[model samples]
Target: MKNLLNSVVGHQAVIDRLTSLVTTNRLPNTLILSGAKSIGKYKTALGLGQNIFCKSKVGASACGVCGSCLRVKNEQHESLQILKSNDGLIKVDQAREVTHFLSKQNNVGEYKVVIIDGAEYMNSQSANALLKTLEEPPENCFIILVSSSLYKLLPTIRSRAQIFRFGSLTTGQLKQIKPVDDWLIELSGANLEIMEKLQDSSNQEIYMKLASSVSQLSESNYDACVKQITSFTKNKQHSLVLIQALQSLIHASYKKSLGMSMQKIDWQEPALERLSALTQSQIMELFTESVKFEYYQKSNFDILLIFESLFLKLISYFNGEAHHASMDRYSYTP
Candidate 1:
């Protein structure tokens, strides 16, 4: 039988475990699929939904061509509810909607499945609003919380669910899913979302330019880095891609400094070599700032100011000046 679960790229162990639970009808009411971003946790949730609602299941998997399977594939299924974040948050109103959704009868299938992608985006109020549902879910209802940041979820919510951790896909597995250039795959850190972003020619161009600027960065040329990055940061999505790309470079450089062999990409080697010169502590500082910059970007901070500030600190690192700027000024509760 052509199984829908077979379509998911990696995480075979998770698939097998889920298949057993579904086949035995012992699947939990609440599940937490925790992992790094873009490693296909949501896809696994969808595959599980398909198997649960599959009308023509041969064994423990969906037929992938039945009416129920197609609807789920198209995200048009009546029983499968997928909630994604808006403006980087799943607010209380969305939580109320989920409660309302599960409250109603399961008219279309044996179960009502709610998959919240980026589950950590749920604020305290929203998480509290959904706690009752999590604690006492209606019979035949399944809620799958998909998150890259498991620590951010409320303990009560985590306590009520079965947690499954996912890891990054391997190069071979990534290639099987999408046969892109090897450098592109490495740049994505085996993450599907970043790989997709790098597929665009324009994004590739921006990545090269950014990589070159950062690789050659010095105290005197730091302003050039700001100009290059700010030009693309005007688009929020582009800014995110740029930040992730920078982080990838930093990670690769740190590994190289530790005597790890990285696949040598012509365009990126110069930057990697440049970054590898920093001490381990310096590398960590850059990484820490990058993470904070990413958080601010997602939280709707002033993009231009943050980008400029980030470059200023970058220059200080090269100039041998201690980075003393307080990040609390840009911090928000979210």
Candidate 2:
């Protein structure tokens, strides 16, 4: 338990609560671990399972060296089952198979633990199949549903499970774990996993490219902005990275406009400063539109028009013109 708690960055309150529940032998059979992506809900579930299955526990903690502990650590435990979506949804057949798996007695371990990784991806048909099992969960069996969005889950399934909400770390809390840049942390919305990954990844080239595009926008070079974005959208993966880079710049500038010191690298500060020309609300609108365009891009929207529309919106905002681009509906094209 001590090691497990230490491995996770933040959310000590949830850990303490789960620890207490385990010690009291009153942990819920079905638990909904709901929180933002990369916020440690899945890790918490794994830790809780490890502690519970550890045969030689010492004072409300896992021994870490026991056979059960080793299996859980290596994810080789027979009693532990992990369910994930295929393509985009967890089909009804998969949910039914899990129900069948739970029906059997646990011969290898004392408890049967099932973790639905993207619980929200369970469509209505699959959710109903799983709901039957939740209604009458087998003894010594545990179900941990992990989701970033809880509202997507069926109400009946949620009602039977004890929901535990996880939260992101604050700036001060994040600093305790690693020396992550404050701006990067804000960009990740305080998700430590995402912040660390972004830090380690080689995004410098794309960041520089994105910076140049922003410079063009600052110069009121609408044609250049369109050309740059059009070239970027050619590679879907690169285009997504550009959108993220834009979001980071917008966020940094928004913070600076509110009297906060800019958190990005020194070179990027100039472009961010130029973006500070717009009010906080206008900056927010632009960021929101960029996010929408990214989503539309994923759904196979017309790439040329999407980037062109985005460039036009940014040009209008910078020129002090209120351009209302109707995002009420997206026109899909192959």
Candidate 3:
């Protein structure tokens, strides 16, 4: 809850740059912290805010135990305002609220920090409202837009902010954060968020079931595989995780086809061996389709239909019935 910069797992370069900027009083008023989900962008934003307001500073970082740091961590700081999505979108009203908050005078620190987590969820109207603020933010006000899909943001909004891209954590960095099983690590693709989800017993069961189903995919079991995978799609979050797991399996198979070594996880061997039969291009297509479906999960599309289409494509590929073509050309009818 504290989200101190010192507690961040990776992105040392970005942190160092931010620290230097903060020390020199040259940090931009508007910043876009763009990265994959759960990679510490929001945490870094809070940590920087804490450092800015910390009463007992420690070498360009927050003391973490100071009263100011505690307030920021607990989201009770008067000067720091965080706006998250309502339902699935950040409405114009929320953007207006941000405008109003920024217009006010700072209460506790020299700077008032506004963090828009999940900034990509801003609809057109909300984005336009927020754009006016980004164009000319109030003096001593800092706004950090944390987004996983930067491209979804309006081009005008993106142009007004200084962007810092956060990359995926390495295995070593992930382990430094917390010890994780090798199989889970491999499945998570070194994503802390996915790894945390996989750690849940129920989620793990779902993942295992998915892996098992995918491993046995064949002409004989095609209908059963579709039914089983679609059953898991009743939960949107579980569906996303399954899609991610599918991508991981395809990625491993792609690597194996190239004579690359895979994680020595015994359980994944069957899936890897089966998927390795796929040509590199075929594997790439499946991976791309999975990524597409993952994005679709955020939309209002029919989840069951989406997974069914995905499994159909996957089974076709496994049966050597899929061809190298743009997935756009492939149409699905209910």
- Per-residue lDDT over 60-124 for candidate 1, one digit per residue giving the tens place of the 0 to 100 score: 77898888888887788999888999999999999999999999976555688999999999999
Estimate the lDDT of model 3.
0.81
Report, for every candidate in turn, its global Cα lDDT versus the true structure. Answer: 0.83, 0.76, 0.81
Put down candidate 3 lDDT per residue, 300-333, tens digits, no spaces.
4676776656655667777777643565344432
TM-scores for the candidates: 0.77, 0.82, 0.82
Top TM-score: which candidate number? 3
How far in Å is the alpha carbon of 78 misplaced in model 1?
4.9
- Say which candidate scores most in lDDT: 1
What is the lDDT for 295 in model 2? 77
Clashing pairs in 1: none
Off by over 4 Å in 2: 85-93, 106-109, 171-189, 192-204, 218-220, 322-334
Give the runs in model 3 whose Cα sits over 4 Å from its true position: 1-3, 55-59, 106-109, 233-235, 295-334
For model 1, where is the 10-residue window of minimal lDDT?
Answer: 325-334
1 against 3, candidate with superior lDDT: 1
Evaluate residue 182 in candidate 1 and report its C-alpha lDDT on the 0 to 100 scale: 85
